[model samples]
Target: MEKIKRIEPFHLRKDREYEPFLQFILKILKEIDPIFHFENTVVSEDRIDKPYVSLKTIKKIGTTNQGIEIIIEELYEQVAYDIAIERIIVRPYGLNVDLKIEIESTRDTTDQPYLELRLIGDEIVNNYILKLFTQQFQQIPLDNEKLKRELLILNTMIKRRQWYTVETRAKAILDNFPEHPQALLALAIARAAQGDLEKGEFYLSKVLEYQPENCDALYNLGVIYEQRAEYQKAMRLLQKSLVLKPKNHVVLWKLGQVKEAIGEIRDALNAYQEAMKTTPNPESKIFTSTDFRKEAKEAIQRLMK
Candidate 1:
């Protein structure tokens, strides 16, 4: 039996939007079959009518004495295809969004895993990466504690690419988790995204002070320097990060850029090719978002000619 690890009963508020102070960590629980089912659950052993996502499972979000209607979609190669929820099921289970996941084993090879992430109580539901619930309403939120929900919402906003909202949420997170590395990184990225590299640099530098060799922080800082045309500084940092995360696609891509900028076409081409060869962790969902993967391929093609 699937035990309730945690339960922040769902609440419904239409037209409810996101807040900037929230952050989220997408986690995968169990893997199921790829033939999508709503009322059916996909579990380890085949059972009667087990769907990965369904109205029964989704109704939990609206179980707070209300009903909700939302749409779920499959994103194929940057194109989003929608799955409409014609009506809200008022049953005890929950759903109504595009948060889905698929079995990742090579034996179950599908073109891509149509994963959806949803934040359920403290023990996140291993679902819904699309959005996080907020508590602007009177009812108890997806999580009883407002702060946790805020973090979830913030992460969702970041995934959605809402920069202004991310900056606001990042500030909120920093105010509370003062030394939280990820929160600091989020804020720095938010600032850099909005064209304020100096502020971004300051926050990232702070992160490095706490965990000096953090590859993500190091890589991001290096990118910031690259943006500022400080090639030597950027090169030094990127090289340091590569030492830690030798196969990191983003790091290798940045190295390609830095080398190209320094008039080292041959070295740049080699770096891009190396980037193309790196394999990312499928569960982290970083591969899809790493545009440099495609860029690296294109760059190699261009350079070879």
Candidate 2:
């Protein structure tokens, strides 16, 4: 039997062009599963007179190459747009909108041209390869060797700050095993790291659905709510997390920050002091506990004054 070739994982580089990076993602997906095909579904344009115009006139937005050209044309002001083009892969079904890559293009020729690419999906891909694994290994145990290897790859990618690959690989496992809590948590962390807080919150919520007592999910979700300035919700989740994991210095630090945000100075100070005194847990999956303790010390000193 021919061994399946493992593709080297890739992350978005700072110096790379948007179009090329988009093309690279498509190429990687195709390589992962040759059966999977990409089709251009939606092309939104920004006109001088009008705000956002759907390119209804131009037909044949078929292949991936043509889709990319349309985006470039819209960006450079050669086709129609004046301000920017928004939205891509908006189709709901039939074409697997699982990896929706939306490119918000700018028509500016100034330094630091703004081109924001948003990845909107269920947090991962490469479904075909995962499908093969599922077929070959039926009723695999929770601590199965294959699953362990996949999770090990995820952990390595997380340590290397390869968030994009982490999201993709975790997503592949989820495609086959939706109830896998570890993959869900990994995908949540990956999404949040990449600045998709909405997706992050969604996946974390899913994790809690399976394991309500998950300290990591509770604490991370609390942090997300705090970032969004929802102090009450943050407080509730953080408190629950503390009940499960009293020694999590990061959670204590975050709790302090949330309290400080809502003008509860005394509680915040006490929380920070507690965090500084707690031994930093090296097994923290999402945050560096030592950094949290350092921040907690600074916070305590500031609040005392």
Candidate 3:
């Protein structure tokens, strides 16, 4: 790729006019005859306001053009349950830019799709390429691999009420898949679990916008309403989720809570008893229970039914 010495807005170098340089990097991406065959590669522009693009590809780039050598290393990182990175390294760049690329940093997860490039070598090519590719992928697509990681985080950490970790992971998931139902729901749970009821409600409302009447969305939103003492709306959403999943003991238990909150003693007792009859284990589904049986049994005892 031929580097342009001058850009139209050359005066704005301090203002992150690096997009002009990335044009050359993009050209190089197309021209280079990669020895490794990249698979599952996809490029997308996620945000309209963002100048960079997100690229995700699976490739084994460990060899050279003329069999010389490349910056090679096998660093394993677990992305999720099924998708594990066996070998993580810079693209096989021999006599090419050797910029330190960070796929995802640990700080704020909400601002993403931007691939970070840290210049390591003193080579001119390295500096040019580093600036060219820096923040190129503001964030990658959530795809399936990222979803799996979010799922595990949701079930294990969020369920345990670890609000900080849950919030970070959910933000990471949303960085790629913005307003994703699962991630949105997880964020809602994290906020609500952390006692930030209003923010929790906001997240669930966003989830409903993407998928209205989504079982998990409906139930969780209902639970939030119940917590806030909005018995009517809570019952409405919880009942809707129940029609879709009648055997959800957790939902039934929540319904009982809503009923009791409004002083419907008999109705609450019946709902609590019904919830007690259902199974207490959470399955692989997204918006299901986390074993509220103990809570339901205690509620039943408190109601003296």
Candidate 4:
């Protein structure tokens, strides 16, 4: 069984929208032969006869009184679906607009997962549902807390090497925040990590469009250029990043490599020596088995010959 889960936020006017939203989701899941399970067992059923259940049966679901909670499972013989809806009061006048949806899917694949599959891929299903939801309701304009959570999810995906998932999450953020720097940065990292250097470079350029002085974007783009053997471009970007953060040993090391690549032995040696002398930042997210300082020192020695 292959399972994927995502927690996504939405913006609806009030608790009243929860039932309609639930109906919308149920309509989509109907394509997959879904069974609904409600917290209020009185309304739970093996099959839902009416497309939209009567409000009397699901009273005050998203309100502070009852909170919208439902679980749907047994999707066909090969798939299982689960949806959890939640809302929080984060505004004044009892006018709450925050809604969070947690969707989980588990699929049991036969020998021919794609060819013989009755439903579409899980990722496609999620994207389709989210896209339709945004059109049916409102796309959430993320609050600061929501933004932090979104970025945290991207970071975790990157650490786990889930590049495609990172792309989806980043694109979801961009749907709400078109010029969000961190979202663009995440897309850049995801594209680059997936070996799509051209797309990665484009996304990094977008990041720079919003945050011209973003050191991480500059450094990453410089590394990409270096990989492409665009030494001059790499040197320019790395030098700009170094000016912004003179003590960044990783940037210095990268700059050294660029200079070395361009046959500027003296400049390369200077950069490497600087990298060797600079103290590593304890808070840096870059992790490597080799000591960068030792690597820089070795580069200097190699260049001295």
Candidate 5:
């Protein structure tokens, strides 16, 4: 693997000159190394635009002095109405050269509209370094530490919210660490809140694959199944969770609901009574017993017939 020496950040203006600037950069990269491939790219000029766009490229290379390989993975873009900007991070593995280039070009009147670049690594010959000295001397400092801090702040903001925040942060985390079960569960909760029940179930199942015996996952899966009227599956999962946490009044209450839905009135009544007994407060007592007791009492009175 080639060592990355410098990573540059560029900001492009959203004005009418954006397309030409992008083309110019593309031309420059292709001229330097015809095998160069962009990692992420996006273009948008409308408000009702999708947040993501996918791009695929097939490059044809002629006979070169040395063998070179280029692989681009996960190229995407997020575009806004006034700002059609994209970021591309390239990893050149076999290159033994380090160089930095910053191109700032804009036709806008504002001073903030400029492209920034930093030459990362140099495997090029010393002669090339001397030739590129002027451009290298003008390189801007890359604040990667500051950027990391900003990303952490953004992720924290997502975790503190209800639906949008959780899903966004969960995805951001998963992008970096796909196998994190807690992040999957957080995404499931967010999707459930957003009424995306199918996606929520998928995420919950993923969490269960990592932690099959997780009581919270089992209980929540049971609730989702019950909502979808899958009585048998709901009952089995709720019961399994109850076996793990017998004193959980909420699970007992859910078991009662499932049993009642399945026409097992006596079993439902028993479950409800157990739930009421485990509940900690008077408010919970009313909540667990009011309807179950009424139904049980009515059944008993009819049995006297």
Candidate 6:
């Protein structure tokens, strides 16, 4: 038997159009199999346009009359408002398949959400099931119970500053629904805060997989790289994120830090000045009177000397 490696979920950046794409995929997957349980489901804003659910799961067939339990590992990169489904399926005992499903929804606007379903191998039947599952899911209303439970766990971890526990809980959620973008993001943040920059990068990468234009994920990635002394990579990612949210003070501040680390004193000073310009009044409290600011000012003054 070939070793089964766990597949990672798609990265949906905070500022990308991921939800509509996710929804389109979920609708199709639901149509494929309603009984298939998904884990690590994440929902968040995608490009300020719509909310999307990113999900992942291990699919299994109940013991049949022949007593054979068929298990298939699958992953999806999709959106909520979009009707496109891009999936990869691996069945050890059978032919492996990769498919893209495109569906056009006539019930809405002329730019109907098109669904893209692909069959890479013998998984065409499974694709059909995805179509059926989507139909059924549409009839059901949104259920926030699962989300509430996950959020509660996250809140507890945050309040206690149990960063490790937060990551563990988030991972457990992903174990069941690996495509959950919010869980991925939260886990990334928790990991970074816990000083596990590598793991955080892994999670942040997942966010980028789905939402290429996610400014938050990019910024976070830049921070992680900067911490690791990967100055050039950090600069590139931070610059990209800044392009999307030019007024983001946090990004500016971090860019300053990266520049300072790389000995670009002038650039660093400019970045800090820019950060101060856009920083909100309430937020300024966090950095205004601290030793950190004192050190920063002293460093800038020394740069002049």
Q: Write the per-residue lDDT of candidate 4 for residues 74-151, one digit (tens) a residue.
A: 322212221112122111111122222333222221110010112224555655656665565544567778878988
What is the Cα root-mean-square deviation between model 2 and the actual structure?
13.6
The TM-score values for the models, in the order shown, are 0.51, 0.54, 0.54, 0.54, 0.43, 0.45
Error of 1 at 174 (Å): 1.6
TM-score of 5: 0.43
TM-score of 3: 0.54
- Across residues 107-216, which tens digit of lDDT does each residue of candidate 5 receive? 22112223333344444532343344335423343255744653454445434544444454455556556776767777776667556679889988998999987666
lDDT of 3 by residue, 136-171 (tens): 433345688858866786667755666655666776
Which scores greater on TM-score, model 3 or model 5?
3
Question: After TM-score superposition, what is the CA distance of residue 265 in candidate 1 from its true location, in Å?
Answer: 2.3
Evaluate all candidate structures by whole-model CA lDDT and list the values in order.
Answer: 0.53, 0.62, 0.58, 0.60, 0.52, 0.54
Task: Give the Å error, residue 126, model 4.
Answer: 20
Sort all candidates by lDDT, best to worst: 2, 4, 3, 6, 1, 5
Candidate 5, superposed: residue stretches over 4 Å from native:
1-161, 279-305
Cα misplacement distance, residue 4 of candidate 3 (Å): 21
lDDT of 1 by residue, 1-305 (tens): 11111111112211112111111111222122232223322222211322333222221222233222222221222222222121111211232332332211110112111112233332234322222312221233232376677666766776677765565555555555688776787777777766679988999999999999887788888989999899999999999989987878878899999999999999899899998888563433212355577889888898888
TM-score, cand. 1 vs. native? 0.51
Which of the two, 4 or 6, has more TM-score?
4
lDDT of 2 at 110: 22
- Candidate 1 residues lying further than 4 Å off, grouped into runs, are 1-152, 283-288
Give per-residue CA lDDT, model 2, range 100-140, as digits (tens).
43333232222222333344444334344334423432333
Model number with the top lDDT: 2
After superposition on all C-alphas, the RMSD of every candidate to the true structure, in Å, is 16.3, 13.6, 13.3, 14.4, 15.0, 16.7
Of 2 and 4, which scores higher on lDDT?
2
